[model samples]
Target: AQTVTQSQPEMSVQEAETVTLSCTYDTSENNYYLFWYKQPPSRQMILVIRQEAYKQQNATENRFSVNFQKAAKSFSLKISDSQLGDTAMYFCAFRRGGGSNYKLTFGKGTLLTVNP
Candidate 1:
């Protein structure tokens, strides 16, 4: 079974400042996928970014990027030019490479507060 861990329970970043959320996973499968999801107070789980295990290159989306270490099984999310809207509960998730039920297993979550 794969388990995701977020060491930090809470984090705060000034508006426009950069923030990095840590995540580590335990899995034996070489082929898998990692994801970073953000849930605002509205409670909608939005996909921030995804990294394929086989890909050496990290994934980026506008202001978001991931540092994927396959050997370490670590996938951390970096939020650059953070904004007030980026203040949300960030969760790291994982899914099997090829399965009929690609259900995501999420971390406990990291509450990020952006102070303006």
Candidate 2:
């Protein structure tokens, strides 16, 4: 069984600044995938960025990047040049593909507020 943890329940950041959200997961599987998902007030989950466990280089998508420490099992999300639209509940999820282990285990989530 795997579990995800987000130490920060809430975070506030100013527009154009950067904010890092903490996340650590527990799993014995060597091959897996980490994901950061954002859900705005509309309640739709959007994929922010994803990282493959085997990849040495961290995954980045435009302004969103992840610090993936495979040994520590920590995958944190860093939002650069933050915008008000980035305000939402961010969830850290994990899923190991192949076979029947294809279910997503998500963290409790961190509520991000971007202030102007």
Candidate 3:
């Protein structure tokens, strides 16, 4: 079984600044995938970034990047040059790799408020 945890329930960042959201997971499975999902007011779950457990390199997508520490079971998201549009509920999720069961375990979420 896998479980994701977001220590911070809420976070704030000034516009054009940067913010890092922390996440930790517990899982016995060696192969899995970690993901950061953004849900805006529209309530759409958007894929911010994804990282494979086997990959040593951190995953990055534009201003959104993830610091993946496999040994520590920690995956944190860094949002650079935060914008008003970045304000949303961010969730950390996990899914097992290579199986018929594609179930995802998600954290409670962290509501990020980007202030101007």
Which candidate has the top score in TM-score?
3
Name every residue pair that clashes in candidate 3: none
Candidate 2 residue lDDT tens string, 2-114: 89999999999999999999999999888899999999999999999999999999999999999999989999999999999999999999998556858999999999999
lDDT of candidate 1 over 26-107, digit per residue (tens): 9987889999999999999999999999999999999999999888889999999999999999999999998688889889
TM-score of model 1 vs. true structure: 0.97
- What is the C-alpha local distance difference test score of candidate 1? 0.94
Candidate 1, clashing residue pairs?
none
Candidate 1 vs candidate 2: the lDDT winner is: 2
In terms of lDDT, which candidate is strongest? 3
Better of 1 and 3 by TM-score: 3
- Model 3 C-alpha lDDT per residue in residues 68-109, reported as the tens digit of each score: 999999999999999999999999999999779988999999
- Between prediction 2 and prediction 3, which has the larger lDDT? 3
